[model samples]
Target: MQVLNKVTVAVKGMVQTIKYPVVWKPSLYMFLSLALSISTHEGQFYWYTNKEPPNPGFSQEFVGMVHAVGAVASMVGVLIYHKNLKDYPFRSILFFAQLLHGASGLLDLTFVLRWNLALGVPDAVFVTLEECVSRVVGRVRLMPMMVLSTKLCPPGAEGTFFALLMCIDSLGMLVAKTGGAFVLRALHVTRTDFSNLWLAVLLRNLLRLSALGAIFLVPTADQTDVLLPQDLLSSGSPAAAAGDEEERLLQLGKLTSHTDDDV
Candidate 1:
């Protein structure tokens, strides 16, 4: 019963959070689109081991090297975001990042179609470069989202709110993976037959580009404007917000609704 009550409160908070316009659509777009876009590469790992042409695969060792390079590139991306893009507005940072994110998908396409080989680039060199760029762009695309989510947390309950944010992100990942599975099934992209894998890559790139359309949902303001809007900060709002929050806390048993206030 205690677990049930906590789940109920969490669900209620999630609903309230989603309904809150200052955070809803932007959060939805950011989390869902990025995850879904990445999921397009699902099963590609196995495809990399298949020994076929035009749809040919890389050796295990080469793939491992590519992954290592990509992992290092991801760390580099974090440093770049911290040092360079940390001060930028969420909208501006997301705009360029999404653009770069979508563009980076082209490297996937290039690999899938063996265009890199046609252009005289060795597979090892090309794949490593592609992996590195993708990781960096992905990190850049995601950092602003993490920063924004943190800023949206309410005072004194940041841990709770951040956990909810993580749940929301996890939900997006679930949906994306499910969607990618369906797409792969529909395209008949099996481990043994990856001829249609290029199509999947193309479609994924398009979806990544589409994330830009939803950018308008993101707020273009300071953290203060986002956490508690101007109206909420007005003279008359504190008592109401505090009372409402206090009542909510009591119901959740943090303040214990059954307890005497005077005591």
Candidate 2:
């Protein structure tokens, strides 16, 4: 009964969130990005599991190397973006990440086509490099969204609103897994039979690229005030309401600054 009640409250909260245009737009962009990337994410696992000779399943050592590279790249990306790209338009950065992510997916296709071998690149070297760059860009893509989620929450309901946004993020992953499974089965891509694997990867990359269409939904961090609803305006004097809003923004910034420090 307790769990049921909690679930009901969560459902109500989510419904309320969707009614807010500002929240829904960014949420949609995040969902689309996650859904589109599922193909590439699952494709990597399939590659490691079903690869053919000379580049068959990733050895334990290779997996460790990729992990190390990803960790280092993640740290570097976080630092650089925090210092440099933090203020850049969120949508623009996301679009750039989408392009880089597509390029990374293309690297998967290269392995599928054995282009790396044809080009005389060792499998380990190429895969490691691809993982490093792709993971870095992926980290960069997420930081802005995290910061945006924090800032987008209205006063006094931060926890519920942010959790709902994260739920959308999780929903994207769920959809991606479902979509990837469907595509893989449709393509007959089994653990051992990977003949149509390249096509599957191509499809994934295309979906990722197509997600760029939703980029416009993410507003710039600086544009938040401009996008606020007119309902927030004062009932009487415009000057007084504008002044009150400015004070609210100032308080919000202080709150965000403290939150950043905690992070």
Candidate 3:
């Protein structure tokens, strides 16, 4: 897990340096890759555990195949977007994708409940759905908010900003996993006990979503427009405006001196 966290942080740092628009689609694909990987793994684990002994491990193998497919898809997406990097910004794509992703999570709850009902454990469905919803709220919504927070950093600080974001996610996962295990052990409860815990978890996720929604209430940061060196020298700074005459004359004199030396 530690090694995985380091690798993810490094990738996020690299993502920070990528030019926008083209990066947007690839980043979305990357995020989906992670979400799908984690979700499928967890789903299979739960599904397998709930079954009888001598399980063939089919669910685990299936999830592994799904993750492999997601990896291939992400690679293809990157190649496809390689030429269009600056046409779309990251925030726009992230926001829209998250909205869609969140809706999908909510919609899945109905299907999950139907499956539970078919299995004659309708009560268990609520607990499973609550847990799934919490995960989706964190990954689909809060994760994007964390990424957006890094965009507020100064230009050269992008790597550090993203690294910190990754660290937070890693820590959050560790705490949630360990704490959940401890609670389950201490309570000596079976799978059915999860239903009793569903309300608390659901409320917690609601609070998390509400907090992320509040970020929209804040003002957006000023976008830094990329320009050529000549454009910067001509139009951008106070120094450029007041010393343009002297600066151009000085540059010309240096060029002439260099030419004379070359001769």
The lDDT values for all models are 0.76, 0.74, 0.41
The lDDT of model 2 is 0.74
Give a tens-digit lDDT track for model 3, residues 117-207.
5555543344344344444333443443444445433243345545644654565556545544544445443443333233333332333
- Tell me each candidate's TM-score: 0.82, 0.77, 0.40
Tens digits of per-residue lDDT, candidate 1, 1-263, equal 65565556555654555476775767777685656574766568878787766545678888888899899999999999998988888788888999999899899889888889889998778888989999999898888888888876655346766787888788887877877888888899987878788898888888888888888877876533456455533532333344456567657775554465646
Model 1: ten consecutive residues of lowest lDDT: 232-241
lDDT of 3 at 232: 31
Off by over 4 Å in 2: 1-14, 40-46, 49-54, 221-263
Top model by lDDT, which number?
1
| Candidates arranged by TM-score, highest first | 1, 2, 3
**Candidate 1 vs 2: which has more lDDT:** 1
